[model samples]
Target chain A: MKIHIYQIAITLISSLMIFKGFENYIKGKNGQTVLKLLVRIIVWGGMVLIALFPRFTNILASTIGMEGNINAIILTGFILVFLMIFKLLSAIERLEQSLSQVTRNETLKEIKKED
Target chain B: MTYFENSKIFIVIPAFNEETVIQGVIKEVQSAGYENIVVIDDGSSDNTQAKAAELIGKMAFRHKINRGKGGATKTGIEAAKLLGADIIVTIDGDGQHDPKDIAKIIAPILEKKCGVVLGTRLLNPKGMPLWKIFANHFGNFCTWFLFGLWVTDSQSGFRAYSKHAAELINTRADRYEYDSEVIREIHLHKLKFKEIPVAVRYTKYSMGKIHKQGFINGFKTLYKMIWGLIS
Candidate 1:
């Protein structure tokens, strides 16, 4: 069994990311939702698994009907990036709406106080 | 005496960093025979609130944070509702709208002709710039396409709403798109609306304001309106 240096580096980075995700959840920062934490953990866990088992990439590529492992990885990366972008955009829109509502309610409350 | 003389007309001025023109706008509205003025200062870093507050008989409410013009206008509407307003007239704090037109805008509502009355500058766009005329037409077209409601000046901030219309037309947009959203609300609620030709004052100061409607904001507003429909 030959272990590549790149595999070691990838596993190390992925492990650190997984740990950080848990740490953030524990700290209750960013209003982290359970579903968000689960998604983060699953993504990082999959990265760690792929780095530890290089042969799994071949299986994944074959299962996905891709010609090569690199192609499979690139496609998956693009999908993940786009999905994350969409999720972030939705979150931003929700936050903006909430902020506007809060500002409006506060302004109205002050007016009520004056009256 | 005018038809709306007996009605409690609340002039809602949604201001954002308009310290330079807040007081003058309030005075103009005051001189226009409207005393129940509600100035919603949308979290201006300047002295817009103080200037508006200095004017007697004007109720000034400041948002702790900058909520776009739509948000401020919504707050003004809600405050006016609480203050027992029979008719609410929203005017830009930048002083672009003629305060004298307040009477004309609210007449349709007082006459029971419509639930909502919009002041259109396109009919009498005398001093309006060529670019503004084009932009307003584009906005009107977009509002028609998106909201299925068309008016001469869909982007006009100077509008008068009867208490029923004001309470019924709840908007979700917090920016320029809110103007279009009001059109959607009018269509959805089947509220009778009238567009009256109103004079617009295009001054160097108003045109110079970076926050006023422009090319980029127009596209952003269009995108937001689409997004709102989808989401």
Candidate 2:
């Protein structure tokens, strides 16, 4: 089935948002503090509804672009994109830890002096 | 009452089944000379309530079971506010946080600089577990990128908040996410925040103690950051 650019984007973004939101909720993510777990659950539920309702997805697709096999493409993209983000986070964490050690040493020295 | 001779600072110690750890925490805070300390029980089944029973005039609130860390911390702040505390500082019941850092943590707020003080452990992620270092930096980067503000560490549980910031952050997430989610609101509200370099002992005892599905949950933290970015 051919799809529209808008539909493709809407479907992809919504799906990505839902997936990431659910992932955070399941993994005990932090932003859930504002609405509690309700917001994450609602986002996950919405994703399920979108996947089930082709018309809803098609409407979103219509806004994105004229397309074909957009859902499959989006699903693939979501997985790859998340993996890439994961890698990016890992690299950044490694670098930050390396930089903070000196400050941490000074912090310990100050704590001891206070004693 | 401006950090003068007779100033009062109430501490909110959130204890979750902390029979072993609560004692030292109370003693530690007392040693720091913070008089108006309050411990919120958060419905612990153990001797948590009993251990903290010695302090006179200290308000204690207990949840039936567990309302989560965020709920417990909120209860402490609200109770401290009611008790007329000039500043409220949060100390972890578990021995993971170094109590000596309290003064540094609260200095800015005591001086009326920043509304909130976050005890950041970002200065030395190298000596820690690889997984934790990875997780924390990713979360910190997302916070900095999205909010356009810099906080060296976002995941540390130890923190100090001015009475104003305490009240502002009283309504935090009901779980660990409360730590990150509060950062969002702090920015949204345009409240000033500072990250004080604090020491943390990351022993196996202090690990996140994830349940049966630990890996899956860590993945969810990553997903949460991505969702924050996309949204």
Candidate 3:
């Protein structure tokens, strides 16, 4: 029932992340789909809610058959790591495709010049 | 029964930032009596294209941007195919490769001894750097381990391929790894491969041009070979 400095800090950080994720979706910078955007917003929003209300995490932890209140934070941490790795892999795939395209285009240009 | 001298042979020199030495290499090849020459300038910022321009009859290709050595070599192969080449020989743009050695490497292909002729420098490693020799051995070992193909030098840039082999040994690697990829292709396609001892001139510039990741590149190439096979 006590709001601490760490809770306030976590809430602010998660809010910023949510705002940036939405901003990127709106600006079309990341080429995220509507579904993907909603998922990101919901995920970060859930983090913000959990940060603001620590007792809610205790309920989630117990429901998930986890022992301690800290287990919720551990679960969130694992989810964040998995999401980051997924994002990195997709980004690398995109980069590889673009690089191959660039190389093919350049090769075609040279061939055209020869003619 | 077709001799290389009578066939339509196309020499593809893949050059990247070799503006200083490309002209001399081309002239040397011309002097060796090889009429068909194509230079694929892999988007050099210098006057490599301009210097090659003086050769009126030969073709010079310039990539719009810097594609890697593999891309340039692929472009050169395409140009050769367009010219209806019977034999395609690829040589480095740097003067490290001897233009005269083209005949020696192509001789096997002409004699029907092999479809792919690799010009190896390890036999007479007189002027070759010690690091390069080690690198070549390491590359050969990786090629053996990955593809069960063994050669004296798997990383040699100077090679001759029959038109069929050249067309068949396609690769997607856009860097120095293409050298290793070619060996994998040769093996996968079940082409007859031969190795010939050839001399190489290792100038300070050419030596410096060797990818510093020669050792690491072997592993990368092996990974690519496996990925390519499965995917």
Model 3, span A24-77: residue lDDT tens: 888888566787777777787887788777688889988998999798888888
Off by over 4 Å in 3: A1-115, B56-58, B210-231
lDDT of the candidates, in the order given: 0.89, 0.66, 0.81
What order do candidates take by lDDT, descending?
1, 3, 2
What residue runs in model 2 are displaced by over 4 Å at the alpha carbon?
A1-115, B1-4, B55-58, B124-127, B145-148, B170-172, B208-215, B220-231
lDDT of 1 at A101: 85
**Candidate 2 chain A worst ten-residue window by lDDT:** A102-111
Best by TM-score: 1
lDDT of 1 by residue, A23-69 (tens): 99889997677887898778878777777886788899999898889
lDDT of 2 by residue, A25-108 (tens): 778754355453455445545555555555665665666664554774486359557755864775564443333333223323
Number of the predicted model whose DockQ against the real structure is largest: 1
- Candidate 2: residue B194 lDDT (0-100): 85
How would you encode candidate 3's per-residue C-alpha lDDT over B144-202 as one tens digit per residue?
A: 88777898988888999998898798787676778888888898899998888989898
- Pairs in clash, predicted candidate 1: none
True contacts kept of each: 0.80, 0.00, 0.24
Lowest-sum lDDT 10-residue window in model 3 chain A: A103-112
- Candidate 1 runs further than 4 Å off: A1-80, A113-115, B1-3
